[model samples]
Target: MGQHESNTKLIWQVFGFLSIVTIVEVILGIIKPHGLHFTNFLGTSLLNWIFIILTLVKAAGIMWYFMHMNHERKNFVNSIILPLIILIPYLVTLLLIEGHYIHEVMGSYINWKY
Candidate 1:
């Protein structure tokens, strides 16, 4: 059927997009650009923030197409997404703060002659 063909095409398109994003992530991880590594944002390197953001984007894309969330009502989608939107950043911020604190405390011991 024509509808089936179109759906198949759309699926392939989404698959290609997802693959490209994944490839980019892999390349970035392998290269580990020094600028990204050295530049700090939110108490962590820019590279880490980029990885986290790209991961979230991939997750959203997977949910949208594979999980059929795009077909759901706006209200329903918002209900499901809103809590995650609120929670993910909150958790990441807490993680960064705690991690920075721990690193700071530990760094002081590195140069001390025991």
Candidate 2:
């Protein structure tokens, strides 16, 4: 196949996959089944997991195809993604830990006041 034809095919493939994923996400949101309502993981809810996964998939599609990061130099890709990879986890952990501390303090103070 010619270069233009190959690129067109790849673009179509990505669009098709994203469309299917988007449809599924929408269906899941509308369904919102009972079992999925309260499912929890690592202090995060299952509905939260669904939203996070969908957002990450969208982010990956934008970064890889829309932004053309997949075709960029390896060093450039790493330069942009590495800090996000590192910082996101660090920030999440910091926020969760601080939230727990606040929860504990509030629980104790409320108990003492009553």
Candidate 3:
């Protein structure tokens, strides 16, 4: 049937898009270009920032298309997404702050042999 064919096409398209995003993530992780790897942004390496952003993008795409959020009412979608939008940044900020504090404290007391 035409509907079945269309569904199949859509499935393939989603699969392809997700696959491409994953491949890009993997390649970037492996290669870790020196410029990106060395640069710091928001207390994290540029590479780490890229990974986080790409992960969010992939998650949003999956939720919107695969999980059928796109068909839901605007308010329903906003209700679900708003918490995540707020939480992710909050969590990231906490992580960076705590990590920096730990690094500073450890550096002050710990001696390196190397």
Candidate 4:
């Protein structure tokens, strides 16, 4: 009974943390501060950067707790997470490069009105 109660408490705590982070993400998305929304960093707006970072944090938390990665060996955890850590940046870089190329190519021909 005690163990069950403790597990329930832990579940609630994790739920609360995840909920708070999600709420913050949603609020920021809706109310995008002008300062953050306008500033560019690494070819993306600061607000976008914040969203990416918060999403990563939530993913890490879910993996560590809900997926029980925290109990695994360090090497095992690294093996599972390292690829994701590497893949995201690589994919983002690819996306940025492709988008820039497309923009440049289209700009030459389109004469965008806006």
Quickly count the clashes in candidate 2.
0
> lDDT (CA) for every model shown?
0.89, 0.77, 0.88, 0.86
For model 2, the stretches where C-alpha displacement exceeds 4 angstroms are 1-6, 90-114
Ranking of all candidate structures by their TM-score, best first: 1, 3, 4, 2
The reply for model 1, stretches above 4 Å from the true place, is: 2-6, 106-114
TM-score of each: 0.83, 0.69, 0.82, 0.80
The numbered model that scores best in TM-score is 1
RMSD of each: 3.9, 5.8, 3.2, 3.2
Candidate 3 C-alpha lDDT tens digits along 11-97? 788889989999999999888899998898889889988898889989998998999898899999999999999999999889889
Give the better candidate number (1 or 3) by TM-score: 1
In model 1, state the lDDT of residue 39: 93
If candidate 1 were superposed on the true structure by all CA atoms, what would the RMSD be? 3.9
Best by lDDT: 1
Native-referenced Cα lDDT, model 1: 0.89
